[model samples]
Target chain A: MSAKIMGFDAYNFNFFWLMLLTAIEVGVVAQSENMAWATLIFVLVSIGVVKFIGIAAVFMHLRFSPDSNVLTATALFPVIFIVLLVLMVGLTSPSAVENLPAFCRPGYYGL
Target chain B: MSDDHGYHHGPHEWSHGAPHNSWAPIIISIGSGVFLFFFAKAFTMNEGMNGYIYDSAPLPLAIAGLAIIFAGLISWWKQDFSFDGSYEPQATHGSTPFSNVDIRKVGMWVFLMSEMMIFSSLFATYIRYRTSIDSCYSLEGTVVEPGTACWLPASYFIAKGGEHAHSTLGFMPDALVPGAINTFALIISSYTIVMALKTAKRTDLEHAERSIKVRNYLGATFCLATLFLVMKMIEWFIGFHIGPFEAPSLLSDQFTIHNDAYTYNYGHGAEAGAMTVDIRMAASIFYLTTGTHGVHVFAGIVGLGYMVVKAHKGGYGPGNSVSIEYFGLYWHFVDLAWVAVFPAFYLY
Candidate 1:
C-alpha cells in the first residue's frame, strides 16, 4: 500500500508484528505445562485475531488504500453467514458433533 | 466491436475491450461435473446388495473429464496471457458500490468472501467436534471403554509432543520445527511478494534491473511456498532425523483418518491404563483444515510459478504491475488463513 506505520513501511511493521505474535503463540503452546490451558487458549486466540487483522488490513491493503473501505466491506460480507454457521452448529446444538450425519463424519467419505 | 481485431484468437489482443464470449467456463463446469459423477461411480461400481467389492471402472471417464478441464483452462489462459494492463477492467458504468474499482480486484474479494465461508464452515466443524467430544487426555482415568472416539488434537503431537515428543530443538518439540518454520516462511514470502509488486511498479529503475529484481523477489516467494509444502509432507508422512534432532511424522505416530484404534499413552510409562481410542475425527479434521490450507499454498505455488516465468521474460512493469498486486492479495489471504490455522491447529 506504500503506507507508513511509526515512520516504517506499513508492510514491514505489520510483518514484524505478525512474526513476533506467532512466536509467542508457539512459545505459549510449548509452555503448556506451566500455564493454565484456558490461559494458553486465550492467548493463542487473541494473538490469532490480531495477526489476522494485521495481515488483512496491511498486507492485503484493506487499509491505507483508496479502495480499502469498499473492499473491506466486500471481504466482510460473509461474516454473518460464518457466525450463523458457527452458532447453529456450535452453540444451538449441544450434541452437534454427535448428531453429525454419517456422511460428514470422518472415515465416511474416506478422504 | 473493433474492426481491427476481429476476435480474441490472438495473444496480442486485449480481453476486456473486445466483445469476447468464450465457452471456457461452461466447459470447465461440464468437465468438473462429469469428473465428479464418474469418480463417484468408479468407487461404487463393485457395490452389490449382497456384499461389497472394490471397483474403479469409471476412472477413465474421470480422467477424460480432467482432460476436458485442462483444455478449458488452456483456452482461458491463452486469452489472458497477453494482458499487459493496457485496459483496466472496471465496473464504471454501474451505480453499484464497486464502481470505478478494478473488476478483477472486486472479483478477487468476492472470491475470497466465498473462501471465507468455506473456511469458516471448516472452523465451525472443528469447533463443533472440539467441544462436542471429550478429549482423550480427559478420559485418561475415566471409566470409558476402549475404542471410544475422542479428540486428540494435533497440537498434542506437534506442540506438546505425544508419545515420541523430543526436545532436540531445546525450546519447542522437534515436530513443532516444521510448522513453526512454515509459519515464518509464509510471512516472509508475503513480504517478498510485496517487494515484487513494488519493484514491478518502479519507474526509475532500468527495465533490465527492475525485471531482475522483480523476478528475484517472485522467485524467492516461489521457493518459500515450495518449502512450506515440503515441510508439510515431512511433518505428515516422513519423519526426519538430523544428528540429535528427530521428529516423527503424524503417520509414524499412528494418526490417520482410518485409525479407529489408536494407542494413546497417558503420559505414563508402560502402564496398563493405556487405552485404545478412535482418533479418526481429530485426524480427519486436522487434515481437512490444514490440508485445505496446504492446497491453497500449492495453488499459490502454481500461480507463483507462472509469475516467475513471466517476470523472467520482462512481462511485468509499472503498467502491468497490477497483476502482482492482485496476486499479493491472494497470497496475503493465504498467510491470513495460516494465521488462524497455525495457532488453532498446531498451537492450541
Candidate 2:
C-alpha cells in the first residue's frame, strides 16, 4: 500500500512538511526566552538532526535505494562525528577545557 | 561485421570494443594537481618564509595553475560533446555493487560523500571549540576564568530584546529572520529542481511545444538557486557587515571590537554591559564553515547554468535523463549541507 499523509505524495509532502516544521522550530528557539540553555541546545540539535536525515532519505532517495549498506555507511559518519565530539567534551580535564578552541570553551554554552 | 573504427569480430565483441584514446582525463588530472599544489602552498606560507615575500610570492604559480585548470576543463567538455553519440548512457558492470545505478550517478554520489567529510571536519572543529571554552565574560565586562568548578549564571547567556547576554566564546544574532528566509528559499529550490527533473524525463523532445516545458522548469530552478545566493549575500551584509559599504548597517551597533576582544550587547541601552569574548577563533570558524558552504552553493549555480543551456537545446530526454538526476543529487546535497549549517551558525 502506498503511504500518503494529508492527501499528498509521501516523499514530496514529507519533505515540504519537514522544512516547514524545522523553520517553525527555529523560530520558536530564536524567539522564546524562558527555555533553559540545555533544553534550547537539545531542541535545536534534535531539529537539525531530523532535518538532515529527512532530506537525505526523501530528497536524496536513500530511503528507497536497494543498497542500504552504502547509504547507511555514509550516514553513520555524522553520527560518529557527533559522538566523538561529546566524548571529547565530556572526558577533557577542566584545565584542558579552558585551552580548547574559543567557541568550544565552557563559557559559550548557549551563545 | 568488422569496421575501421576499432570494431573487432568475436562472440564477446559487444562487451570488448577497443578503447579509444582520450587526453581529457590526463589533462584534467595534471591541471588539477598543479592548481592544488600551488593553492596549498600559497595558503600555508607564512611571513618570512624562505626569505621570500609572503603576500605576492605565490600569485604567479596560483594564477597559472588556475588558468591551466580552466583550460583543461573547457577542453574536456568540448571533447566529450564532440561526438554525435557522446551523450548516450554507458553500460555498467553487472557484477558490481553499483550494477543498477548509472555510472555518472555513482560518481556524483562518491563526490558528495567526500564533500560530506570536508564539512564534517569543519563542523567537528566548530563543535569542539563550542563545547570546551571555559571562560565566561559577563555583561559587566568581568572575565570568569576557569576554576576547579567553573559555572556561569543564567543571566549571562539569556536572549533579551534588542540586547541579549553574550558569551565569551561567540554570539549569533537572535532575530533569526534572515536565516529562516534563506532556509525556506533553499528548500523550495530543491523542490523546483526535482520538478525540473520530472518534467525533463516526461518531455518529448521531438515535439517542440513539449520540450519548452523542460526548459521552463530548469530555468525556474536556476532562478530559485540564484535567489538563495542573493538572500544569503543580503543577510551577510546586514548581519556581519561583510560587504563593501561605508554606512553603518544593522547589527553593526550591537558589536563592539576592542583589541582582540569582541563584545556583543544583548540588552537595551547603556544599562546592560556587553558580553566580551575572544573574537579570533570564533570569527575564523564562522567564516570558514559558512564560507565553504557558500562556495559550494556558488558552484552548484554554475553547474545549473550549464544544465539550463543544454536544456534549451533539447539535450535531455527520457533516454538521457541521467545528467539531470546527477545534478539533482548535487543540488540536494548542497541544500542538505545548509540544513546543518543554518542551525550551527545562526540559531545556536
In terms of TM-score, the best-performing candidate is 1
List, residue by residue over B100-194, the lDDT tens digit for candidate 1.
67777887888788888888989988988887887888788767777899999998998887877789867788988899889999999998999
Candidate lDDT scores, in order, read: 0.82, 0.58
RMSD of each: 6.8, 7.7
Largest lDDT belongs to which candidate?
1
Compose the digit string of candidate 2's lDDT tens values, residues B220-323.
87887787777666544554233321222222532211113444443446665555444444445666787799878887787777667767776666655556
Docking class of 2: acceptable
Clashes of each: 0, 15
lDDT of 1 by residue, A10-101 (tens): 87888889889878877877788899766777788898889888888888889998889999889888988988999887545577666554
How many collisions between residues are there in candidate 1? 0
Badly placed stretches (over 4 Å) of model 1 are A95-111, B1-54, B269-272
Tell me how each candidate scores on DockQ against the true complex: 0.43, 0.26
